[model samples]
Target: MGASGYILRRLGYGVILLLGVVVLNFLLIHAAPGDPAEVIAGEMGGATQEMMDKIRADYGLDKPLIVQLGLYLGGVVTGDLGESYFFNQPVIELIGARIVPTILLVVAAQMIAITLGVGMGVLAARRPQGAWSAFVSVFSTIGYAAPVFWTGLMLIILFASMLPLFPVEGMESARFSGGPILYALDVLHHLFLPALTLGIIFLAQYARLSRASMIDVLGADYVRTARAKGLSERKVTFKHALRNAVLPIMTVAGIQFGNLISGALLVETVFNWPGMGRLAFDSVLRRDYPTLLGVLFFAALMVVVANLLTDLGYRLADPRIRTGGSRK
Candidate 1:
């Protein structure tokens, strides 16, 4: 129940933060100098002044800026994001359709990051003075410190161009119907490059953080107590020290997940993945305001939701979080 209350409180805060981001999205797009009608209609065809005027009226674009913003915000609260001029479809629908691939990419990259980072950190922690620890530290540093675009390009050049081991770009081959199995395989093939790129960024942070946290935990009084009690070395590290060492790493990792959803703009662009990062990049180029705003909103929503989940995870992983009972 304490954890539940903490989650509820965190969710409430997330909603408030989401609203601020939404309002900022609206204002930034609306403030960008060129008229929305001009941008929207120009993309559709060569929009005439009269047509542009009509479109503006249709979208409430001619309303006082504040009034237009009010309606947009109100409509957003009521679950309408307006229609896309380019797609001739509900903006929500377009975003919804594109979101799954992006979510998958984020999740995949996240798993890779956590697995590699935590594993390496734990390994390094166990043998602080060993060659294995040194090697893991160096590899993780490269993963973290390397620029994402550079890493992505290097991977493509190594695997795709030189070795001919993987495809150069895209989420799947156009040849298949994107079936349950074959499609999954094709996507995995296509996704490997971009996921690796994103995973490298995450891996670096996790490796460093987990290693540091573990090192610190090893020196804690409880850890010393456990060791002095004649517990097996494995039991000392895994059963006892690992749990507490992981708390800070988990907290930082949760925040990084938010970044992966937003931070892959370059990676998506490089690989031509049809994720929201790429969609937003394309939308910005075309001045597709509705699509851009919708994708941005989705990204914001993802960030908040990830943070909330991380908070829940914190409680589950570390009993001390809930036992202290300051939540609600």
Candidate 2:
């Protein structure tokens, strides 16, 4: 198929996948044990039946399940996330405020991990037995095996508590009198620990994947022929092998981006960073249905988008893909 045709097909599938996520989110949240009204109330004892009835009626909690689901989906289509029963605030507004910090953190982490990982992967594969390569391989293995929360705690102990070099938790200094630049610096200090924690956790996989891909590509007949034709090592490795090798790495990186958004639930809790992951944790604890649903839906969207990009990477990596619709 043509490029536009392929894009249209992928986009159509993406829409279907996203809608399924919305449906699944609704079903799962509904399945969790609790009355919609009482869950919204979230520890009510002194309230009257009138207050409960008003709350239910006001939020459309009194509607039948099917009707409510339809209304929820409709609202999503219209970009109305509705009000959170637990917080008594609009869900969309709340998420908007929290998403930026999380996005920045994730993006920073992605850059660090991919740069270091792919670079080291290429170097190590080129000289597998070199002392520096061995050292990196050992470090990468350890980093990958280590638990993220454990790494965060250790960093906190070593840098934050022991040396006082970085903030222990939270995104920034609460009482800082500084403006945006200083505030950003403070946030970066805090973010470094968590970002490194995530980066270290991811670096091993990227490096290992890239190194293996590069090695396999280097041994291919084309690479050998290019070398026989007297291409410089740098040109042969980077211009030729690296481009083809990176396609798998791109796929891995894209999927990990989505996983990072979801997986940070633990990291956020550990660091007390007020991102979507942390917000989702709070919503679940309070049984705030709208907030929880919105968060999950967004995460699902991330996964769908990530997978789509990975598929697109196949075309970028190899021209043959443009003709045949296959990775080859």
- TM-score per candidate, chains pooled: 0.91, 0.89
- The C-alpha RMSD of each candidate to the native structure, in angstroms, is 2.7, 2.5
Residues 252-297, model 1: lDDT tens digits: 8888876798767778888888877877887787777878888888
Give the Cα-based TM-score of candidate 2 against the true structure: 0.89
Between which residue pairs do clashes occur in model 2?
Answer: none
Using TM-score as the measure, which candidate wins? Answer: 1
Off by over 4 Å in 1: 177-179, 228-230, 325-328
- Give model 2 RMSD, 1 decimal: 2.5
lDDT of 2 by residue, 30-136 (tens): 88897767765556654578888998899888889889999999999899888887778889988898887787777777777888899989998898778867877
Counted clashes in each candidate structure: 0, 0
Candidate 1 has what TM-score? 0.91
Q: Which stretches of candidate 2 lie over 4 Å from their true place?
A: 42-45, 162-164, 173-189, 325-328
lDDT of each: 0.83, 0.83
